[model samples]
Target: MDCHNYITVFPERKRGQHLGREERGAIQQLNKQGYSLRAIAREINCSPSTIMYELRRGTPLRKSHRGRTPEYSAKRGLAVYEMNRMKCKRPHYITHCSDFVKWVVAQVRAKKWSLDACVGHARLHQLFADKEMVCTKTLYNEMAAGNLPLSLFELPEILKRKQNKKGTRKHKRLKGRSIDERPDIVDLRTEFGHWEADTVIGRKKGREAAVLTLIERVTNNYLAIRIPGKNSESVMAAMKELHAEYGERFSSVFKTITTDNGSEFEEFSKIEAWGSSVYYAHPYSSWERPVNERHNGFLRQYIPKGVSIEKYTYEDILHFADELNSRPRKRLAYQTPEELFDAFLDKLYIA
Candidate 1:
């Protein structure tokens, strides 16, 4: 180690400790002896940058005394270290945004909104200035550090994330046409009217009510209609009602829809004659329709499994879908699904 750059010496270095007075003195001595920064660090079992920073931080000006040569002083280094020690404490500003925090907590608890959604939406709307609001990570860190009133588990998605289960690889029957034949434009989601459909059931044994959901691929517009049961008839009835509601515009609005191989959607392929196209996903492949599956997870926050959806009225289902559609999505550049969907409609009809 003392050979000092004449040879490269590899040694086990001290890790993650602050600079000490002894290290500073060693730096001064080695530097005075014409040793390079790397050589000094190798001899003292530390990093070259540590030596370089310490030299920069503590080296004093000697422009008058040495005509521009400034020497490293151990006494000066220790004094600088003491000065940096005083600045070690950073003020905790998590409490500064109390109002914003309350609004975020309320939205999470009442609306089942995600933290990132709440933060991003607020920022996009200018609800709070830079100093008045904390980032999503900072809010999570506040919960982690116990500086906040709530725990991470109190959030809707946090606990459910760990509980996500793999679906059965059971036989999934293919109906009508395959999604493989569907246009690539549906996947790109740039144009409107393409949708992914799914059925959410309640109380596997005794429940008769289910939610027939359709999310627009482009605008992320979510539609959840309460069906009579988890069967082909119920799904078909709901689709007919949706067809009747939009009338002439129905075909244009729902240009194409992608569905899973659930028994409930077995007769769903009948919509092919109704002008809008219907396509089926592959067996046991939920990833093929990612946006639909993700929104289903969000719906689980309201209509949890093993509970009866029969108890909730159709109006209640509409309200739940409305809330979800109104919430801003990060993928949509912080725009709400309802907003984007309406804009698309205006473009299609008015333009």
Candidate 2:
């Protein structure tokens, strides 16, 4: 063949290819001109199913005319095709597991379990077959797709707070034993009695009731003691009451308590007389006592910010802690905080 006479022919569309915008527009135009689905497919050199899907997608959501049947618009077809294309990806395998979806929604709504806890607990207990449930990330993706009952906003706590851009020097008074001097065993988390303490304040103003929280480092066990106020007096009184209740076991139950330099916990070091060690985190270093800070943030889900803590009863505060303690933690090998805490107590009592 002479180079001058050579003709390079490109098929309108290759076999097993997706329909392009031009092809979709053409199908819509031909269909409006009264072309059959098969005729449109042949004219565009595509499959009948492609033409069928295009027309079906391009059809208006509502009725178009009073008497005449709605016709496909090329513009609408192209737009729809593009939108669908933007969403094009591998069909998530998790979406097909309706049973798993039901379980996830129930766990979140009734049990108030976090997404990771739900998946981790299910896998740990072998509650469902491997094919039935999805991993944590897949479960979240399903929620994002609106396949489950959860929305991003309905989640108890998900996003992290952004730090302020302005830098300022913070002066936090370390009134108790410094965390730097604490035993290495506490940081190792191999022992059970090590606790991180903090306060949860509502509305962040006035002399409102607050919750005194303690989290066991080993098992993520949580305790919330509602106090009349967040003063040194109230904080010390709560610890004394707990000490009286637990008696001799109080020392073993609370081996060491780590806390920030909040005014309320300034007197925490006074509890050192109970044979319990009290340590304070460095100034403005909330991360130094992460367990206490994170669990306190979780408490906000129930008592919420900008709301008065005075409204909730003492029992309500305990209930919130109980709910969290009963839930499984991924780091705990799916064991609940309550279960692990009780087991540790039993061991201590036996010892």
Candidate 3:
């Protein structure tokens, strides 16, 4: 369904609201467009008083030449700078109560409380006051400054932020296909024939056998196939089964398949023979295959470590996959994979 966008004006009650410079510019444009004060108020969703004040004082007409000097040259800029400086000048209660600070840092490390939450909790218990409550940013700064030992905060696990490394060369030989070689259409998932694939292995062998996962990158709709083994034949069989059940609709959606450098995905040519392009991720680079890895995580909730995939009937696996596929995701704004899949089909028809 198609919908038109419209803006609604705010009520007159919010009297103390301030308009920024861009808003003042908009008021100037709408006023010159000959919109009535009430009409402009309704259009901007501000009160008539707001519009009147904005028209008279918020925005002054640009003069042909420079006129009277302003009384306040450094308005908000000076205020913000001074406020930050004042905050910096405040004494550290952390230094006085090093024990309490260490405890708070430990709580943060355990994810028991966010910095703001800890500060609020501390204030409630009289552990700290408004003056002593440290801001989240300030706490992070203090941690980075080495004034406090991060080890006390379990810094290795707690404060660690991992980002994908760049400028790294592929570990495997170039004889194997690379993700960069995949077509642009595959990246877009325009017709749905493109798939992002990943293999899920477990820490415990018997509890979780490897599973091959595929996700439609665009819609984030996904499917998982439990593979008894990590061999090329096993991988090929799973791909073939997925294709057989989904048929042409599956064929229509899965134009290309991309996987990581794991040897299990060595059956790329066989998969490509079924009319799909196959690409491989850089070795040790899971971030490039984020969507498929996410589905694997979901599967792990059911078949975690120490469980063998051989124990799960294909039916059991499919049922679990269906449950996952049917559940609504917040990234899709609570739309189920089924709904999004249907929407994609509708879009395909419209096109």
lDDT of each: 0.86, 0.84, 0.65
* lDDT tens digits by residue: candidate 1, 113-160: 788898999999999988988998988777778887676766757666
The prediction achieving the highest TM-score against the true structure is 1
Question: Which residue runs of candidate 2 sit more than 4 Å off their true CA positions?
Answer: 1-89, 161-170
RMSD of 3: 19.8
Collision count for each candidate, in order = 0, 0, 14
Model 2, 182-258: lDDT tens per residue? 99998888987999998888877698899999999999999999999989999999988999998999988999999
How much is 170 displaced in model 2, in angstroms? 7.1
Error of 1 at 293 (Å): 0.7
lDDT of 2: 0.84
Evaluated against the true structure, the overall lDDT of model 1 is 0.86
- lDDT per residue as tens, model 3, 62-110: 5556876322112333344456668888675557656567767776554
Flag regions of model 3 displaced more than 4 Å. Answer: 1-167, 185-191, 203-209, 248-250, 343-351
Alpha carbon lDDT of residue 334, candidate 3? 46
| Deviating ranges (above 4 Å) for candidate 1 | 1-17, 21-87, 160-172
How far in Å is the alpha carbon of 164 misplaced in model 1?
11
If both were scored by TM-score, which would come out higher, candidate 2 or candidate 3? 2
